[model samples]
Target: MTNLDIPATPGAAVARTEASPVGRVLAEQAVRTAAAWLAEFRKSPSTPAAYARDLGLAAVVEHHQLQDLVEAFPLPSVRTLFTRSRARGVAPELCWFPMLLDLGLHPVLDATPAHVKGWVALMDEHRDATGQPVLSPAARARRVAALSSLLRWAVTEELITANPVDRLDRDRAGLVVDRHHSPTRGLSGAQLDLLVWTADRYPGPQRARTAALVALLATTAIRVSELCGLATGDYFADTGRHVIEVTRKGGKRQRIPVPPAAAARLDAYLATRPDYGAVAVPGQHGAGRVPLLATTAWRPGAGRRGGGQPLSPGEVWATLRRVARTHPDLAHLADQLHPHQLRHSVATRLLEAGAPQQHVQDLLGHVDPAMTQRYNRARDQLHNSPTPLAGQLLERGLAALDQDQEHHPAG
Candidate 1:
């Protein structure tokens, strides 16, 4: 073979390190390095990391860095981060949470068995009245999505080289298609009349206030938060029509024209409005004034007050529940009624009344015209049922047959 050189085989001599567990320890260290980087990235964002979060977890989640993100970003703990991501406003979840800890990251990414167990325990505590998990099929999906977001945030922060949750079957983890039928199911006309009559059954300021709150929800379709968030300034009376401006989700604002009945009730309530420091600025007028809803709980500059102060969401819900129990007509409607249902009811009624789609969309502050179309389509089904018309035609056809029978008298 003379001086011919031989090419070395790929695995000819694998270098064997005599150091026991050296390879394992190095791999472990690499994982921890990635995890620590991820944690910092979540608090502080980077372009590549953010892109990973967007692509891997959720579409709505925007990247935020520790420097740029709010100090009170509300990402306090892992649980809170999950909850805020899932619950705040009507945003969708990212899909990377279910398994991100599997990748090597330090701190946030290190999957302690205790952490998983604690999450499962906490989730179990969120059951509804029926004791079925309140984090229903839909909610579980949202939770998973939220988890995915945090993991993706980890990736964005460079905690790991790849998204651990990238292949997580979000659909299997309860993130399924949401088909929401409006649960407006408000009081029927007669039922509403009965509720009013029941309200009238009580006397004095208590009756007035209760009636006003009920009327406000039913008529304005304002959210419970917006209703409770109200200050005297929210209502405008002098301009031929009364208008109440409500702050909705996403910090969006909408001005709803209140009917005379609700306006009258609101006026009555305002006349008795106590000084929770929620007065209207006389000359300025409309929408930009203080919050329409206020409670003594959040009194201006008051140190702190608990339940002794004015109403909270729970307080308002409880009070409304009590009112429902008092009235037979409203009793059935009470348990089902929420402040949001009032908004849905208003949207439904408006669409039913042939209100313009654009008008409804604007009134509801829907970001998309398609949302208004949904209500319009539903309203059409309610008022314009073809089945009923078909039934009437069938009856008329039978009547003609009856006349022929009388003429022929065939056995």
Candidate 2:
């Protein structure tokens, strides 16, 4: 076997020769193929880079002799692939590499249709670090779809004769794997109230700031990352409505309307800061580049150097968790609650209160209506009542008995 030379950087171009190791050649070809496909498909910049890294790792694990590696690859599986991949900083999607490694299926030339179905079964029985099932049915389905895409690309390139994954009946797979729509669990009204109350009464030095942060999260449904990225200039009163301009996922800018109560809490929190009034111009209200949620680590001698640094997503999570841990009412949710749950809660609350699906979709900044529909379906299921149907049946049966007794004059 020839010694393999892996590139230090994924973006670096490598010159290949006829003498180059089979694994290296295969890896380079796969990356080139993926790049060409991505260019034509116009995928996000990060997609090609990630695929290059992942495929390169796959090449290394197989030692470049694709045919021999696939036939002899361990079936029951060990963590060797994962450990090696991590050392090279080429961690693929969770369980993706391991599943492939365990199957030892050749990507292009050798793997058969039965091998693909066997892989599906393996994923179904796989366990996580916590001893729970590794992938939910939906998650498994997504992973399969991703794998199928890659294989289909290989087939188009004529590297493979056919795409075996395409032969697997999707409807049959769905029947075998129970596909349930798992709704995002959000904080209930009581949970939200308790969280805010706890934050307000926190004895920590950053109590007021924490209170405001919780209030904003509960009301706005903005992601923690977006909240952390906010600048004071982003918050302003527009036409009698308090609004905050935020950059959502995928760099989309959105103006989210803040609730009056939450705005008041934010104002009170800002008033406690010495720089708030100084930063604002006399004519313009809420106009400054200062971070809306600045770090609490600033001290007098720090000389404003650390003052404007925004609270990180980790800090936001820790703050909420601290409040949940301290409050008796929220103690049960201490382990389960997080900032994203607040987003889910807001979405659910809006749908339950008769908000239009499209309006909620816009509020959440979801590009896909299907995602918004999940929230609507969950709300509908929650409110659907069996009592009405049961009540009608009972009433009809009782009325029939009453009429018979009256007509027969039973004594």
Candidate 3:
């Protein structure tokens, strides 16, 4: 391998020594640090303390990955090493792994613009392979977010001093990722009545209970995950205000306020709740707290004396399916329905009603107002219950174009 000199960078100077063995050890440390930091960031959200630790780790990983490249080939800089490593079938996420190996043998790897582009290409490949571009808008946003977090870590570690992914530019492509448009898809006046009627047929104690769950999701716009996480004790019975505490993706908690109608549904569900067993302690809201939803198959066991354990989110889907199957009219509507669609339905209704963007953001636990605005946009594009008139118009336009082509006779 050619001897590579570490360029002087103010206070940060790479030591160039003849001792290749010692240099290799340093590179290994760098690789380990990068992996450790990435793992830590995955476990924790973007906090000052978390970023600090990740920065230290990024430095280690970048050094090692670069060292491995230098030791294997006559690479002059970190950028060349990254290119050579990528050509050897190394993915972007695993770029640190190879870079760390190279750094263990050298002082520092030179990261260049060309090499950074190569890294970005690798990231794009991995993203496409893992169903990012082709997935739902929500899923695509989530994947981009995950990749951004790792790239940010690289920035703090001074691996490349800048996030290359941030430099990726996109042109006008129909709709931006995070932007919300008002949706035309919502239950019509008659369909809404049908849904309520079907939900009401759940039989006895299950009647009001099941209908309430669906109604609350539509009216309150709370996430289905948050709905399932609720406990019977989450409500203030006397005040008639139900507070739902939700833990979002990054372990951030947002408390959503439930309306009076939702509160009444919850109260009704609580009233009909069968006596599973005794309360372990007074006002312990955690595990010992009464489960908000339980199944008929639920039974008391070793630590669980309650009649039913807390219902999993899957139960929510099953309950909806059961109600849909029981009612013919509702079956047509509910067959293609998902819990999140109900959330979209509610958000659309609220935005149409002229609710404040900030209020919607707070209610939906969205980190940004832009995200909450997509629903608003989607709502405007279509009315409540998209009519077939637009479809008919599209067909007529296509027919007219075909007739014009026949008369023109291009051949």
Candidate 4:
């Protein structure tokens, strides 16, 4: 059999040659193994290879002895699928896997919780040219979140059976922090309102799209990735509610009811285009295939007589920054305004309006309530505390009983 047909184990490959098995494969960068696996699977008539192959053999996988391509890579191959579009996001995270391999967790099967911790520690300790730590708390959080995402993808690809990142003590590992920093601060309530208003001042063509994009993000709090991934058909009537479906982090599709202002703006913007916003749902095909927030500048001369390319996350960032710069009122925010801050603004605004904490958590799609609770920096104020409100409610009942005794001489 050709070397191509042979499945090399770490020990076996080591025995065959005195080279470090991890360094050997990684030196060549293992792009060949990842590509070969993808090529073999892509040939399937039904595309079983699109998601399956020798994924099964990887499951006896947890206790470290690395398997062939099972431990080799779904990394570079999966990254290709995402990097095809800038909006797919997380390509930078995927880039980190090679560094992970360099740390001796070659097959991915070898990554344990301790290795994950050490990987993050290395990143945290690394210094940049400024002589400060390269990763801040927020940057460290992103690395952990990115690692979690990668490990989860590996699990789904069945490259390995268990996720070491999942077992991580997220808070202890410094991924979750109750402490708020300047980085976590979002726009003030008035600032959020000003942001949407700022969209109206977008210079030149397609102001309707600019307004709708800003309003939807400011009002609903969807991620920039979710906003960019939205298909025209994702907006549809659901039992009298105007709901928009978005692919959330990790490919989870969620439908959130659009508020009146966002819905009105979106509908008005959609009216300007050929599709009129009444596109088919994603699974239903072509009518819904166009981008919901397409940029007029993109593919201006191409495609159907109507639509343009979907906005990338970078485009969304620029749009917000541009809108902020347009108005004197938003000048201070021009440099710092971003799509994520809009999302953060939405969550905080909802909480400040006395919306239930649980509802806010659900609205923001946070799996951990702690993540949601971290947004309310003012929640501890006794003046605004719900406990006093409860006591006041009881006082009204006591007052009523006192009135009854005065009127009827009740015991």
Ranking by lDDT: 2, 4, 3, 1
Predicted structure 1, TM vs. truth: 0.53
Every model's TM-score: 0.53, 0.54, 0.50, 0.61
Candidate 3 lDDT by residue in tens digits, 210-254: 877865665556666567655655444223334554444454554
Candidate 2, residues 80-111, lDDT tens digits: the string is: 23123233333232333332322232244444
Q: Judging by TM-score against the true structure, name the best candidate.
A: 4
lDDT per model, in order? 0.44, 0.56, 0.46, 0.56
Candidate 2 residues lying further than 4 Å off, grouped into runs, are 1-123, 128-131, 138-181, 271-291, 296-314, 367-370, 373-411
- What global local distance difference test value does model 2 have? 0.56
Q: Candidate 1 vs candidate 2: which has greater lDDT?
A: 2
On the 0 to 100 scale, the lDDT of residue 250 in model 3 is 53
RMSD of each: 16.6, 15.7, 15.8, 14.5
lDDT of 4 by residue, 1-411 (tens): 011112333432332132455455552333343444444433121122113211211111211233343444344323322233222222222224444343443435555676666656655566668888656666567656645655565677797788888877777766674443346568876667666766765776778889899888876677776777677778887766667776554445566777666787788888898754455554432332678887664444434424466676677898888888887778888887788887777676667767677666666666666777543221112122232222232234345645765899725
Model 3 misplacement above 4 A: 1-134, 154-164, 170-178, 182-184, 203-209, 237-240, 247-257, 272-290, 294-310, 351-362, 366-370, 373-411
Q: Any runs in candidate 4 off by more than 4 Å, and if so which?
A: 1-95, 100-118, 127-132, 145-176, 179-183, 249-252, 275-288, 297-307, 374-411
